[model samples]
Target: MTALEIKEYIQKNGKIPYVLESIGCSNIVYHDNKDYYSCSNAVGGDCNNPAAINIRNNKYLNYRNYTRGVEYDDGKDLISLVQYNKNIDFANAMKYLHKLLGLKNLYKVKEEKKKPDDSWFVFSRFVVKRRKCVVNDFDPMSEDILNDFVPYIHIDLFREGIIKRTIKKFGLGYSYRWRRTIFPIRYWLDGTLMGYNARSSIENCSEFGISKYFITPGMRKEINIYGLWENYKDIQKAGYIVIFEAEKSVLKRDSRMDPTGGAIEGHVLSDEQVRIILGIGVEEVIIAMDNDVPIEEVWNMCEKFYGLRKVSYIRDKWKLLGPKDSPADAPNKIYNFLFKWRIPYDESKHREYLKSLKKNS
Candidate 1:
């Protein structure tokens, strides 16, 4: 689609039945070997195929991409992008997120000025070396890796397929809050298959009160967001993303949060993650954390990096609907409040909103 055609051709999918259908969401369950993914029906597949989302060399944290100033995927809690690169700033941010997550040095990589046609910096780690999912229509993994490399207790959204069945056939699997059969998998931003994060189900983890859900030995939440690369543009266009506390938030129909794993919700940003934000060249960053604890502390942190001018907050009004630990008490209600944000970014409106919250509190 041409740049002009995007406004018309930018296809969109409204609510569809959550089932495996090629016409719907390219559903299947089986691997094609040669590192190509094996897919299956979620009804018969393992819990969910865990694609090895190799930030490969990049890094991530809480789902926000700093380098390109965009959110990556639609799922809110995914690992950094391994397969495809979207939004240059986001891909670049993931690289630094990797570093920030302690997957690499603390420094986020600096963005260099380049032509649009220049090698998209996001692909540098794998494109030149031909790592998994870097090649289009080329599956570069083994069934063993597909079945034994990924862990999903932290990152939830699963892709549909047989791998998802494998988990359920035996009685255990995390359904992708969004997307398809999870098993070990990977893909590019254009939605091409890249690689998978396959893993063994937690066969015996109840003793420590640990759910039997299996996870890789070393996947770190401090290191990456689950599916950031997929939703980079929306984040940029939206100018801000509403961070959620749980990975499941990405799957459920909650407008207050990013179903794409792009929102940044947590206690605070690490120094490295903070630095990653600068790397992206973002002029504004509105901290939209849930009003769980000290908004003041969070405010201090925001001021440290983005300044009071760029910060914004969504006062936790979970009580507006009912008593609970979620905005789910009234998802639509919360969403309606945020919907007004879709308009252009105006300073006066943000101030009014903030002042109103302060008076109410």
Candidate 2:
């Protein structure tokens, strides 16, 4: 079974109490009214706080260490809980979780039933017209609310080479309680406050099975393109906009004074996003999604801008990026290479590229 498959299986079949015990959480106490169990802190040390750890919904876990105040695991998976308490990476944690579940070796475990392929192209076609479902008016949040968060930059982001100027320019904040770097999201057209995108600050957070981003509830991210509120004028002036998969990529480009927009999701662009991008009146669009996205799917994303505007996409054909690294995720040289050599989207060329990928694989 794959890591995702094993994680899903654990969620479906694993029990909360057993998982807690396996991870060294003693004195587990269930709260009947709240539907959560309090246990000895396996995370961040107990300090004799018998019920320091709280497990809720059998999936999410939080702990309040005496010194740390309160911290929640962003990953919100059973394996993430294990990973935290055991001080192990995701793969080792998965192996431990499999043992606790009495499952076979991680690789040897077999699925009882075959699962459907959930690739982006499989559903993107159907959801093309569903873009009208976006809600226009959201309850506005005060900009002053950002004052409640510290302007502390996480070490991981610093390691990513995000400097103070770019961080301040975007109004990024750090929440000690949630342990996430906060991105205040606003309306793309008018800069009206919409909500916030809280991202985990932990190093290798996604690999450790932590939820990478947690947007405010009911915030429709797909309808809004990040950086538009800040860079629309620049985008229009440049006559082109580079579209990245995440906000960090946009920030990376911004530090270089390169105007960009972020889909804030994956490679798939929503119709509303297309509308927003086209509305920017840029003559050209550059798609710079992560390296792992299938070539055909990248072309499908480019298909959204066909004919109306010049659309190109950056791919690591020169072997500059890691398997899943985005163009902006790398140093300037790697990023410059991919961006400078972006291929103009053409149906025939897209097909040829697809054939080459298949042949090479």
Candidate 3:
């Protein structure tokens, strides 16, 4: 019979037993005074019980959960019922149901399109070739490496006391061959090393065609927060965690995580990362991005954590400090501002802070 004819016959007579017989289903049983159809694909020669459908109530029973049946609407089609019971894609399930009913190619149905093969898209085709620097690979946590490079690091970027404390606390190291300071990125507190962020220590390195910052290739920076592995326990202890842009800011604040620079604009927190923060039982998240970052960019970063409702943006608090200054640049001023406002853990505070800053400026 054609698909249209079978559909019309089922609608008119409601002969579910006959329909099951036509679809090659056998060994039907009646339980709870209800007709139960056997699954056509039942294995072996033993048909223990009816675990396919309950025609009396227009319900479909999954073989996995025979006791609990799913009821269908009045006008639900056979293809959808089969798809639901079989747990297969729409097109393939529809085709299987249609063929089982002895329906020919009478109806015109759109065929599923094949996806394009992405195996041809390789890294070499799109990656730009550049001059490779010979980096000395050493254990990031080795005492010898730490002792070798720590002496060369100067406290020119941040204060002497803060730098020394941060280096010891975060396992910060340096690479003499690369002429860059090393910041180890870990998965959790003392967890596996994911990668490293290397910042050039040489003066005028950018002018000499040396990139100031270099992230390890294949590192999933988009989903990671720098310093989170080390400071998660401290964050739980403090009841809240501060957010910053640069790694140095995380060190300067001593209880914060940086999304590793440039993340404020393009790489905001991912959903998995948010769940990680929530799992840590952090009550509030305060963002203190660079003072030079645009207000719109700060808003974009704030929007990433909008659903959390415990995030507060303190970018406006740093306005009076100066242009392009970060929390690390003036730690005392930022600290004093945070202490004075006592920024509440409210989402609306961000808007209020922005409004007050604009009004005063």
Candidate 4:
């Protein structure tokens, strides 16, 4: 059957439960006289009723209690709903539905178009709005103030010796008046301090309805990856870069950079960022995200870098390790895994890995 024919059948039949069941959605239940299906992929398996599609009206009320209702029309709308709920792309959604219906070759699913270059968007929204630097207004704090703040700020990091090293290596400082620890964010090209990210020292600030993290006025954290400037030389020397999700994770694991803030679902590598990495002659990229990060996210990242660079990821072996744990927690184990997989660290090894990747491809 064609996609249009299948869609028409579903619309006419008006059996939401059957359609959901065909896709292996168990735990289907009737609530409030409406058929609600819970997606296994949903965190905690608590699919809200609003995400349910109404068979009678042929409309998907996705989070309708909070958002507007999206009417289900053709297969495209169904694909969209599946993408929204399952966290997969349109093509994958189509493939999944088709396979479930035992009609694998029924539809020709067009791939989603890539977004336009975001460099200009980022620059206009972030760079142009950056506050002018006042001469001698925001210098680093004095040693005496820093020493006093060190005890209150990241005590665990201080104990582990990472805090002092990060301060020395990245020229991090404490702002006495601001009551924040400042980490200078630099430009990758010239290592110039373009802005700084200030983290509050007060542990309960967030609990008390305060912002724990603050960026320089008009600085968009999403546009730039943290630690990229400081670690670019090491990344070039290593021929591969290890990417983490948090700036603290980068510091803990000695990773090259974290994605602006953290990984978002279905986040793709921006063209501008990819160009910069490629320009730097990075041969491979290893995503070493936290254990709780979904495998789908890892696959999404791999797909973004596919054919452009050799991409691999570190698999979490220990279930006890929480999302906040970094490679520094078990450096020896991570190193052993790298060695076993022959992840490149030097020029010759990089060439070998590239050849192997190409062969496999």
Stretches of candidate 4 above 4 Å error? 1-154, 160-163, 255-268, 328-361
- For model 2, residues 61-93, the per-residue Cα lDDT tens digits are 433333335444432345556766787744467
Tell me how far the alpha carbon of residue 197 in candidate 3 is from the true structure, in angstroms, after superposition: 1.0
TM-score of every candidate: 0.39, 0.57, 0.51, 0.48
Cα lDDT of candidate 3 equals 0.50
- Candidate 2: which pairs clash? 75-210, 75-211
> Per-residue alpha-carbon lDDT of model 3 for 1-361, expressed as tens digits?
2233344545455555554554444555445455433444233323345554444423322122233444433323443445544655333453564566444354332323334435543212111221122111111222222344454344554433345556776777766656677776665423445556777878998799878877666555555567776666666667776667766666766632322211221235565455344434465766677777776556655555655546665655535666876654565655657535644434574675467568768
Which residue runs of candidate 3 sit more than 4 Å off their true CA positions?
A: 1-152, 158-161, 255-267, 342-361
Best by lDDT: 2
What lDDT tens digits, residue by residue, belong to model 1 across residues 211-280? 4323332322333332334444555565554444443333342223443223333555655345333333
Q: Which of 1 and 2 is ahead in TM-score?
A: 2
In order, how many clashes per candidate?
A: 95, 2, 0, 0
Residue 312 CA error for candidate 3 (Å)?
0.9
- Residue 140, candidate 3: C-alpha displacement in angstroms: 12
Over 4 Å off, model 1 = 1-208, 212-215, 253-266, 278-284, 321-324, 338-361
lDDT for 63 (candidate 3): 25
